[model samples]
Target: MGSGHDTRVAVVVVTWNSAGVIEGLLRSVQGSRLDGSVRLIVVDNASSDSTVQVVRELMPDAEVLQAGRNAGYAAGMNAGMAAAGDCDSYLLLNPDIRLGPTTIQSMLEELRESGAGIVVPRLVDEFGALRLSLRREPTVLRAWGEALLGGRRAGRFPPLGEVETRAEAYDRRTEADWATGAAMLISRECLARVGAWDETYFLYSEETDFALRARDAGFALRYTPEAVAVHHEGESHESPALFSLLSRNRVKLFRSRHGAARTALFWSGVFLGELIRAARPTRRAAAWALLGNVRGVARPSS
Candidate 1:
């Protein structure tokens, strides 16, 4: 892992019952082709399984922070960053992500050269299909349009949605409102200027909130396709609890950014969207959960 140049990086992997995938991710990190000095820190959010033990056994050199309770991803990441100390960059890596050998070097190079405060790698599935990680800022009109048109088609037409799910969209490196937090490389300068991840998000939309904050603070968010990572996605999609959290948090994020008027409109759009999706057999339960949580979705306890 030598380019004969030194760039210090602290890789923070947040885990929650991630024993099944984290070992491979850590191993991939150990075999990374970067020339930088890297510190691996695993922040586990009170995983009930053997995630902590597995991380300890497989990657003995990694610093492990045992957050005794389920603090959620944002808080867990903050804990990892607190432990990581100072570094040129902080990578908020998801436990289920496996990085390629050249991933770190390529991303770091783009970040340094492009002057972007945050840069994310191209995320693909195990079979090499692109995952739509990039996204535009959320707005009431976009939300309503997406509800009426569906994500895939709505995303293709920019005004219709916030999601950028088109495959060809990832062909070039570009600036984005936010990308998936699964494997983001954030500059220390950005962190210092914009502050830490907003813990109020609990889980979903935390990255969105952070990215928007960085942009507002004059930090650019970039998507560089040269660096690639594989993500075992769909964990949230499979869980009704997570789906409900995502639903509520989507509205929360909109409210935080646009205020009451837009939030109300966006919430209505989201409800209608869920109602439409619920018509499908597979999404019925998740749709019900989301609708149920509409009035009583608990806010993050700060």
Candidate 2:
């Protein structure tokens, strides 16, 4: 129902203890110039730092919604979407990302041209390294391939893997199974049809679930290198517990889509892969994380 001219985009950013990197993100958002209307919304997940205060001070126009306690990323994003009201598109961004001036404008142009429900931009690091963001849906065989051959090599061969690490199609606009959730512009129609993000995932794999569901609903997920954003990837996985939790969530996501039989096989590949990686002297921490999840190998059925 949206043409290029009369579109409205609501940018939603969910923050959790991100006072260190949020200022740059907010400033970049304020700097983005767009042809269509744009509104900024920040949802703070009860950070002990001054993340909320910084948003209020720097980006006063942005709607700041505070969750009294840490509500996790999916819940915070959902809350932000609820506060966004009516809009033709929703831009979900991580607080550590800084958008290029024309990022939103370019994405809007692509949305109108391609008619894709969800579109993501190219993500680079502070060092200007291209972070491969596109991914293939996880499967038992792909999991084994990734676990054995590594992400980069396995990604190149689709029949054997899920992570799309090849950078060939990054520069040219194309459809992808899913891209990182760091910066994505999603159409209003897709959101209404696909429904809200699965809040059950506390942190990781939420984007994958959303992307898969969107694809299932006949919506396309696209990647455009024209719109670039810098993601200061967080050190969340630096914590062994969080790493274990993330691994657990991956299984849950796989189970939700592929059923128990495939999940069991996927889990086996993951466990073997982690075990092999843990054998190295530098990966002792990973060994502990894997050992801690012995009981968590199988998630409870929903």
User: Top TM-score: which candidate number?
Assistant: 1
Whole-model Cα lDDT of every candidate shown, in order: 0.86, 0.83
| TM-scores of the candidates in the order shown | 0.94, 0.93
C-alpha lDDT of candidate 2 relative to the true structure: 0.83
Q: Per-prediction RMSD in angstroms?
A: 2.3, 2.9
lDDT of 2 by residue, 152-271 (tens): 788899878777777786879999888779898999999999999988998888999999999999999988889999988666446665666666677778878775567778887776
User: Candidate 2: where are CA atoms >4 Å away?
Assistant: 1-5, 279-301
lDDT string, candidate 1, 1-302, tens digits: 44344898899998888888888898889879887788899998889999989988987888999998889899999998888886899988998898999999999998999999999999999999999999999987888888899888899988887889788889999999998899999999999999989888888999999999999999999999999999987667877677777877888787776655566778888878877888654356556665665564334223
Model 1, 235: alpha-carbon shift in Å? 1.6
